[model samples]
Target chain A: MLAAAVRLFNERGYDATSMFDIAESLGITKSSVYHHISGKEQLLQMAMDRALDGLFEAADEVRALDVPAPERLERLVRRSVLVLAERFEYVTVLLRVRGNTEAEQHALSRRRDFDTIVTDLVKQAQAEGGVRPDIDPATVARLILGMVNSLTEWYRPRTGGAEAIADALTRIAFEGLRTE
Target chain B: MLAAAVRLFNERGYDATSMFDIAESLGITKSSVYHHISGKEQLLQMAMDRALDGLFEAADEVRALDVPAPERLERLVRRSVLVLAERFEYVTVLLRVRGNTEAEQHALSRRRDFDTIVTDLVKQAQAEGGVRPDIDPATVARLILGMVNSLTEWYRPRTGGAEAIADALTRIAFEGLRTE
Candidate 1:
């Protein structure tokens, strides 16, 4: 049901999509949607939570390893891209949220928390002389996230698998597009 | 009126923002809006065209220069970012279009033309051994664009000026976020 709601939200903007639309898409009654989920907001919260959970889990797994900060950041970047490709619709909806509702505001806050984790990793890498210290860590984090978040815009599972895309992004983020 | 419409479209989803809302926001009658523009679709096209015009102008300026391909690409990126900051709202609306309407489909096509131009520059840079040849030029173009287009998400003219942000981004794109 959440998946159906996310698809509807992605197809029609979330503000334009309603509980009735979700129910109709699933070939169920409107009340049936309420039976499982209280409302459209609830479904949005659930979908965003699902997307955030995948990202946080990936971050946590990378943090658990005793790897150097650069390697850890690379692993997290690769995993986040893979997670985004895996949960494309949910993440797309999350990224598109404009904080018009409390549910969306919460999602935005959680998204920032995820960003802070990456920013801190960038700082750590910089301190260890693995990353360029001249650039602002926060800026680096945003640009890297921007690159990864862009995958949601054009990625199709059929054309390029998550691993291949992740590998390409990892290479670009660390090694850049220039060969000496 | 188009500026007012772009703001309303960005605040409320484009599908949800009615012509009446735009009229009300601008303190004008709906008839006044119709007198100047055909309808909401016309406003969307105008706003997107404005944004694309800025980017294409920047690209054209760089292409006209006799500089090397890498320098041309860098100048284009910097100028494009400055243009995005200067015209934030129009570009934001341009990026968020979902290709649901004829105007949006046209906007998407123009956007792809812009992307292809940048991709060609990347290919030229690679041919000159200015950029790494291992990654696909299309992928390099997308990632670089992903980094630049991100300015629309969080950039505020009052915060970091366009030049500063552009400098930071150029450094990251060329030298990367790493230190030897």
Candidate 2:
């Protein structure tokens, strides 16, 4: 049901979609939707949770690892790529969010928290001399995760090589694209 | 008028925004909007053209440069960052397009053309041994431009340092974030 609703929200812009449309798409009555879900915002919260929770879980695990910051950052990027491929619809909706509603505002706040984690990791890496220090750590964090998040836009789960894509991203991000 | 429409479209999803809303936002009558423009879509087209033309013009100039493929790629990335920052609202709208209308489909096609040019440049750089050959050229192009495009999500034109942003992006993209 959440999957069906997210698909509808992603297909038609979330604001354009409503209980009636979601119910119609699911071939159930609107009352059935109301019985299962509080409102469309609840469904949105669930969908975004599916994406954000996956990311935070991965970040938590990465944070616990007793490794250098750059290594931890690499692992986080890889895990994120897999999560994005695994929860493609949810991430799509999450990425499109623009803080128009309470649910969106909550998601945006959580997203900022996630970004701060990456920024801290960048700072740690720079402090340890594993990452370059010239660029602002916040900017570096945004660009690196920005590359990872772009996967939600074009990556197809059916194509099924999240590991390879993650590897490619980490390689280019850390090693530079120019030949050594 | 186009600026007002683009701003509204960016704030409100394009589908949810109406000509009346645009007119009201601009403190003009709906007919006044129709008189100046054919409709909302013509405005969208003009706004998108503002972004796409800037990119293609930059690409044309980069193509004429007698430099190595990697050098051309770096120049293109720098110039694209400038174009994106210069036409901030237009690029935001351009990136959000999802092919729901004739105008949007046209914009998507032009965007694909631009992507193809970047992909070809990546391939040329790989063939010239200027870029690493391990990763797919298309993926490399997407990831690199994806980093640049992410600026629209968080970049504030009011902060006013496009040159510094461009330099930071180029350094991270080409030299990467890891210290040698």
Candidate 3:
């Protein structure tokens, strides 16, 4: 039911969808949707939460490990690809949210939390003299995240498995896009 | 008038913006806008074209230069930043266009032309043996473009100039975030 709602919301857009459309898709009464959860906004929030939580949790585990910053960055990329593939729909919805709704507000906050983790990693790498010091931490954070997030815009499972996509990202980002 | 129109289209949405609103913002009659342009769609398309043309032209000039791959890449990044910043509003509208309209279809074709130019640069860099060998050209292309394209979402010019941003992106991407 939740998946159906997300699909509908994505197709018609969040603002255009109604409880009636969701209930019809589920072949249940509108009241039944109420019984399952508070309402549409809550459902949207939960969907976003599911996607956002995976990112934050994966980032945390990667941060906790005792690996080199490069390897840790690689692992972070790999895990993100896996999570994005596994929960593609939910994450896609989360990306599309523009902070217009209540659920979107929370998602943005969670996004910032994830960003903080990446910022710390960049700083650590810079301190160790691997990363560049000339650029601001926040800008690098945005660039890295933007590269990964662009995956949602066009990447499909048909290109390769989650792992391959992750590996490609890591290689290109670290080694530059030249023949060496 | 143009700035107001771009803001309304970006915020409320392109489809939602009407001639009356633009005319009202300019303190002019709706017919005056029609005299300047055929209609709203023309305005949107023209705005996007102006922004995109800057990128295409800059990339062409950078490609023609005799610099090494890495330095050329740095120039590309700096010029891209300047183009985006100088034509901030038009670029913002261009970034947000989802290709949902006929004008957007044209916009996308022009976008593809721009991509083809950048892809050629990636190929040139790879042949020069400055970039890595393991990654595919297409993947790297998307990654680099994605990183730079994301600047449209948050970059403000007064705080930082094109030179700093370009240097930072080039450094992080070429050197990796890992301390070696």
Which is superior by TM-score, 1 or 3?
Answer: 1
TM-score per candidate, chains pooled: 0.94, 0.96, 0.89
Q: Which candidate is the best by DockQ?
A: 2
Task: Tell how far residue A125 is off in model 1, in angstroms.
Answer: 1.2
The per-residue C-alpha lDDT of model 3 at residue B3 equals: 77
Winning candidate number (lDDT):
2
User: Candidate 1, clashing residue pairs?
Assistant: none
Candidate 1 per-residue lDDT over residues A1-180, each given as its tens digit: 888889989887787898899999999999987888888889889999999999999999999999899889989999999899989999999998889888889999999999999999999999988888888899889988998998777787567567877877888788776676
Docking class of 1: medium
Note the chain A TM-score of all models in turn. Answer: 0.97, 0.96, 0.90
The fraction of correct interface contacts reproduced by each prediction comes to 0.56, 0.68, 0.59
Stretches of model 3 off by over 4 angstroms after superposition = A24-35, A68-70, A178-180, B68-74
Positional deviation of residue A72's Cα in model 3 after best superposition, in angstroms: 3.0
DockQ of 3: 0.54
Ten-residue segment with the worst summed lDDT in candidate 2 chain A?
A171-180
lDDT per residue as tens, model 2, A1-180: 999999999888788899999999989999999999899999999999999999999999999999998889878878888888899999999998988888899999999999999999989988988788899989888888888899877788889988889888888888888875
Better of 1 and 2 by TM-score: 2
In model 3, how well does chain A match by TM-score? 0.90
TM-score of chain B of each: 0.96, 0.97, 0.90
Q: Please provide, for model 3 over A1-180, each residue's C-alpha lDDT reduced to its tens digit, 9 standing for 90 to 100.
A: 889998887777777899989999999999998898888898799889989989988998998999877567667867877888788878888887889876688799888888788878777776766655667878888888877887776677566566767787776566555333
Return whichever of 2 and 3 wins on lDDT. Answer: 2
Per-model CA lDDT versus the true structure: 0.88, 0.90, 0.78
